[model samples]
Target: MSAPVQVGPSSSSGGPAPLEDLEDLLADIGDRVRAERQFRGWTQAELAQRAQLGTVALSSLERGRPTLLSTLVLACTALGVDLAHVMSSDWREPERGPSMTPQQAVVLREAAAGGSLTEIGARLDMTAAEVGSTLTRVYQRLEVTHVPRAERRAAAVRMAVQHGLITPQKRTS
Candidate 1:
C-alpha cells in the first residue's frame, strides 16, 4: 500500500492550514470523489441527479473546492463509501459509520479472513482474548448480538463484505 496520506491537524504546523495545503487537500478529496464515481460506472450527471446536486456543483467538488457537508454526504452516500473513509483512508465507513469506529473496522476486516481468534490476534498483534472481546463489541454494534458464537465470524464477515466495508478475503501466493 502507498504510505498513508497525512490528514487532519498537521503535527508540524498544528495550526491553520496555509492556502497551499487547503488547495491540495481539496484537490485530493475531489480526486477521491471522481475515482469512486468512475469506479461505480456513473456519469457525472447521473451522480449529480442521485445526490440531488447540480452537475456544476459536482464538477466544482471534483475540482477540489471546499463544499457543504450535505454535498459531501450526498456524494459519499451515492458512492456507498464512508465519509470517514474519505477523510482518513484507514477506515471503511459501513453504509453509515455511526455504529462503528476505525479500529473496529480494522479488527472486523482482519477477522473476516477466516481464522481462529488466536491466529487472528497474532496477526493483529493482540491477544486471543482481545480478538474475542473486540468481536463481541462488533456483534453488539451490528445488532447481531444473539448470533451464536459458532456462526458469528462468518456472519460478520458476510455483513462487512455486503456493506462494502471489506472485500472477501482471497488467497494469493
Candidate 2:
C-alpha cells in the first residue's frame, strides 16, 4: 500500500497542519471514497451532482479538506457506500458468520463463474428474481456494494478457500 498522504499545518505563509490524527482519518476516508467512486466508473462531477453539492465541495472533500458531516454523508450515499462503515475505527478482520450452505454456495459459485442470474437460477431450480434477492442479501452480509465482476469472482474464490464451495477461476483482466 502507498504511504498515507500527510497534510501539513497551516502557517502564516500558508497554513498550519490540522490535527494530525483527524487529518489522517479524513485522508483515509477520502481515499476510500475516491477508490469506490473509481470502481463505479463515476467522475467527481457526477458524484457531486448526485450528492447535490458543488463540484468544488466534492473535490475538497476528496482531497481531505475539512468538511461538514452532512456533506460527507451525502457524498458516501451518492457513491452507494455506507458512511458508517467508512468512518468506523475498526479495520481489523471482518466478522465472519456461519458459512453458506452447500446449495447457497453452489448458487454463489455459478454466479461467480459468470453465469447470468437467469442461468444460475435455472441450475439451482430457483427463479431469477429469487436468485437476485439471495445475491443481494449475500452482498449485504459481506458489506459490499456494487460487486465488479472481478470482485464477485474473488468473493467466490474466498468462499472456496474457506471450504464453503468450489468455483472456477474468474477472469479479471
Candidate 3:
C-alpha cells in the first residue's frame, strides 16, 4: 500500500544500492514492523500512539511506503526492538547536507561523555539554555531533529561517533 522509500548510499562502499534492493529492504522492514506490532497485540492506532506518531504514518510504514528514518526509530523504540532487528547494522544514516562545526563537535563530545547540560555550559561559559539551543542546532544539522527531543541526544551522539566527531568512552565500574 505504501510506496517504496528510496535509500541513499550504502555504508559498506559508500555507494547507492540498486533500486530494487532498496525496495526489498523497505518491504522487509515493513514486514518486521507489522510482525512486531501484531506480536504485542497492538492495532495500528495503538502502536502509533505509543510511538508518538499518527495512524496514517504507521500505516504508511507498515505498507512499506516511503518511511522517514525518524519514524522508523520511534516505532522501533515503542516496539522495544533494536534497530538491528529491523535494519542492517551496516546501514548508515543518510548524509545530512551540512557539516558539523567544531563547536558543535565539542558540545556533542561533552554530552557523550556524560556531562549534563548545566555542567557542559558551565565549562563552556554558556547558560544551560544556551547549551540546549546549541544541541538543538546540532540536531538540525544532523537531520535528527524530527526525532523526539528526549531521544535526540542519543541519536545525535551516535551519529557523531559514526562520523568520527567523537570516540565513544569506555565505561568504568
Candidate models: Cα lDDT each: 0.72, 0.64, 0.74
Stretch of 10 with least lDDT, candidate 1: 1-10
The lDDT, on a scale of 0 to 1, for candidate 3 is 0.74
**Candidate 1 structure quality by residue, lDDT tens digits, 1-173:** 12223333344634322223445656777888899999999999999999999999999989876678446555654554445668786765344642556777788888877688899899999999998999888887776767888888778777766655666677897
What's the alpha carbon RMSD for model 2? 18.6
In angstroms, give how far residue 162 of model 1 lies from its true place: 2.1
Over 1-173, each residue of candidate 2 has an lDDT whose tens digit, in order, gives: 12453233233423223333556666676787889889999999999999998999878877877889546645654443445556778635455553556666666777766677898889889999989887766555454545684576466456454543354555789
Q: Model 3: per-residue lDDT, tens digit, 47-152?
A: 9999999999889877767678556645654443445645876756556545688988888778776678999898888899988988988998888989997788
* Superior candidate under TM-score, 1 versus 3: 1
By lDDT, the better pick of 1 and 2 is 1
TM-score of predicted structure 3: 0.41
Clashing pairs in 2: 8-17, 9-15, 9-16, 9-17, 10-15, 10-16, 10-17, 11-15, 11-16
**TM-score against truth, every candidate:** 0.44, 0.33, 0.41
State the RMSD for candidate 1.
Answer: 14.7
Rank the candidate models, highest lDDT first: 3, 1, 2
